[model samples]
Target chain A: MIEIIDLTKQYGKFTALDCLNLTIDKGTVFGFVGQNGAGKSTTFSILATLLSPSSGTAYINGFNIRSEPKAVRSQIGYMPDFFGVYDQLKTVEYLDFYGASYGISQSERNKLIPQLLELVNLTDKQDSYVDILSRGMKQRLCLARSLIHDPEVLILDEPASGLDPRARVEMREILKELKNMGKTILISSHILPELAEMCDTIGIIDQGRLVAQGSVSEIQQRLKGEKLIVVKLQHGLDEAVRFFEDQPMVSGLVKREDGHSLQFIYSGDAEDQVQLLKMALLQNLAIVSFSEIETNLEDVFMEITKGVELT
Target chain B: MRNLLLNPVLNKEFKLRFRSFKSFLGLGLYLLALSVLMVGFIFLESQGSPMGRFRPEQSRTMFILMSFIQMGLILFITPGLTAGVISGEREKQTLNILLTTNQSSASIIFGKLISSVSFLLLMIFASMPIYSIVFLYGGISPGQVLVVLGYYIFTILVFGSIGIFFSTLVRKTIIAMITTYGVTLFLTAGTAFLFAVSMSVSQMGNSSNNPFALFFVMLNPVMILFSFLEPDAFSELSNQLGLGSEFPLWAANMVTYVLIMVLLIFISVKKLRPNMKVKSRR
Candidate 1:
């Protein structure tokens, strides 16, 4: 659905985006994950045609952004991170305004506005002035504006940011519905776990470069070689960890937190892990709970960037 | 189809111009001022000598001058009002949303220009009664009033277009406003200043020396209105200047005004290119 080649954007001495190359397939939700100042917004702005890339080319569904911008614009819905809501305009009028910009007929826009409001779960607020809306409501209204023309692709930058948990959940549901509608979605967000849950594929960027790109399981498996497991116990966790350190498969045992919880770096087969658990049980160690630790996105992200700022 | 693109801009303009108490007060105050000027004229006329406020037979001139003052107010307010139209959108972060739409840049620029001028027109038209009362004085012609009002509208549109063009070019409203004010000042006032300086430079070229010396005076909108009222003054000045009238005069004035407007609008459209893409980049 989209292709970018050697996309480099520079603002004088500062290289905001560096020779970035990416290809996104149609009908997929792609999560763009990076720390703050990782050039995520820069990349999105280039795609949205809000900012010109200092170098490189971008294509939207085969339409070159620089050449056939009108066609590309007509097919895409873009929600900026920081956008304004016209205070006096009704939610429907706001949608109508954008639809008119797209050359949608008045009757056509009227028909679409109600459906879009419903899709964004803002049907009741359609008659309300946009200014009266909460931040989350306004964000949803922005999303509705983007979709007014029934765009084929959605590029949402930080759509869930500043949203309350419930609002975020609502936005997630709406995004899932969009994904199901077969629209290609590209979302840039700092919330990694949410992206991990929401995206079909993910790209990790650091210092204006893509450090990794894959599904959650693929990224997790790639980092499992240096897997970390932190075990919290009910009490006397130190004695259990000391005994766990002596086990054959347990290569490293460090007190993970305040000497009560221990992190084990184990290199062992499934049977070796069972044996270690048996050894811990054999000792008079109080095991509050024990289970295999799953690697969360935070650890993988930290490992990937090595704590370097992208900008 | 283009009308659809312009409607939002028009609607926005109308809403803001009429809804705000300030706009209402401004328009009402303008009406009050024009009426006061009329009342002053009649009160003095009743006392005889026709008040001698201006030329007696040139009551048409007074009417035209009244409209000219109204036009001046519009010209001033337009730059201050619309200098921030586009740049303010960018500041508020709403411009990006507007740019990404399928609407062409031409539509955006045209819509904004019309919207700004619409507000100016509302204030100008609100003083229609004061203008009509000028006919009560018996020296003013209705067709002349219409023509002068036409020129006033044209001038306001030209000035408003300049304001909007600067709005798009500058990143901040203050800068846009300052640039617009400077340009307006230079084009209208500076032209007269240039004429005066040139006329003063030569021993014979005093206001009497050169017919072409008054050429720059055409740039001043009020001078043109004045000329229409007192054409003999132009000839008398030309006689002193010792030169024949080679200039197309009003034809030249019309062409210049139209050309200025065209240039301002063209530059505005160019500045508002529909370049912002909506699709997310890879």
Candidate 2:
């Protein structure tokens, strides 16, 4: 678990993190969402014990980051956003070096290297030179290096930043596996959908301030104020649209390009929704499908930060 | 102490340094330059003395020349090797990862210093055959050779520590390298120039004895090595300069260098610590 309290970081006159506070529970994946220069990396660096907070404290697994940095460092695995691999070093050597840096013995590293490489799907390239690997491979290797000590918390800053779509999916799968293994993860990325799918909770930071924090649906519901419903018609599309347009519960409606489906924002309770469906059936409207259209994290983010400008 | 010596950064530095062709080429060029000097010294000696006869005095001069050249090489190459040790990591963006590990800043600093000094020692040891050529004529003793080796080690520590200190202070490797060389140059040539001025000032004041002049000479590593090689010349100069014979000159020089090296390493470790500025502010 990670806890940050009133963490503020100021660089001369400019504030990088402004009284930011967040908590990540054990075995939960907390996605940190923000645009560029949004204090996400600053927060990650502070938690990793690589940067000092100007006037705040952070704790990882009950160890304070500023006072007990070594303990905090031992408990967390940090993968930086833009890290470089040592040239002329083999993949296994790279992992072993970091393992030794964490005070892991040779025997331990030897046993752990293969397992970690396999976890990142880089076992075949264990003997290859690190410089010869592609960017995606290097990123995976860095991930494996971070996990060399089997840390309880993972602080990954843009783990899939520059990766291709396939590589990003692979990284996401590995992260999900890490979550299943009971590791607490605090990840920051610009990709909202991936975070929405991967994180138990998402915290949106803007201009060094945490503007929003909640589950995907909670944020969506809080910002949009209505549930979206889609009704697919086999033959009664005009009737369905007319009926919803005249209903008091229907706030907005838009017909799909397919001409057989209609999407509408329904400001009603569950009982009202069920009653509306029953009424449509009684009217003999040929309804092929009726389902709620879920709003994604991207939509929620845009809605929440509608008037806010990026710093 | 053993754990400090066996740190992971030291091991990785050794592996990466020796694995590259650059290390081999540097060693080869170093030995080739020494070989040229050795052969050239013998050739010039034969031309002056005729009959191609070897002499003990010639052997002594050759030993002194070779030691001087080796020390010069160490002074030149140590900065190139160590000035980039930390800044290069920063440039590669690996310093942050290293800092976030459980390894202490002292461990990383010492590991980098030891690794660079160990490679310099390897090159010095590899040129032992050339030193043995001096022993062939029976002028320098094995004890003398041992003392010279010890002096070489101390000099490497001093220069390598300076390199590391600058590496930690500067952000770019090239800037660190230049600053390291600049400081070293000031320590050597600048001290000599100040010593010369002190000598003339003492003479102008009708007192040819100035311990301060000798102190400035002690700041120069080459002068220290020279004093070790030709003790009679040092003694004669001390007699002229009216220096006290209380402490041995070589011991004083060694202590000065060792003290400076320690201070430089301490500052480097403190600079490399992530929270040092915050701690200082508090």
Across residues B158-277, which tens digit of lDDT does each residue of candidate 1 receive?
Answer: 788888889998899899999999988876678778767767765453334554455776666666766665677866655655646776355577788789878877887766753443
Clashing pairs in 2: none
Expressed as tens digits, the lDDT of each residue in A1-311 for candidate 1 is 98989888777788788888888899999999888899999988878877777778789899887778788888789999899876677788788878877878889987888888999889999888888999989999999898888888899999999999999999999999999999999998887898887799988888788878888888777767654656677788767767877776564567765666887656676777677677777886777666667767887787677642222
Provide per-model DockQ scores: 0.28, 0.34
lDDT of 2: 0.87
**Which runs in model 1 stand beyond 4 Å of their true positions?**
A227-295, A307-311, B1-7, B19-22, B48-58, B204-215, B238-246, B274-282
Task: Report the lDDT of model 2 for residue B144.
Answer: 85
Error (Å) of candidate 1 at residue A185 is 0.6
How do the predictions measure up, each by TM-score? 0.84, 0.87
lDDT for residue A33 in candidate 1, whole number 0-100: 89
Per-residue alpha-carbon lDDT of candidate 2 for residues B160-234, written as tens digits (9 for 90 to 100)? 999999999999999999999998888888889998999999999989679788888878888888888999998
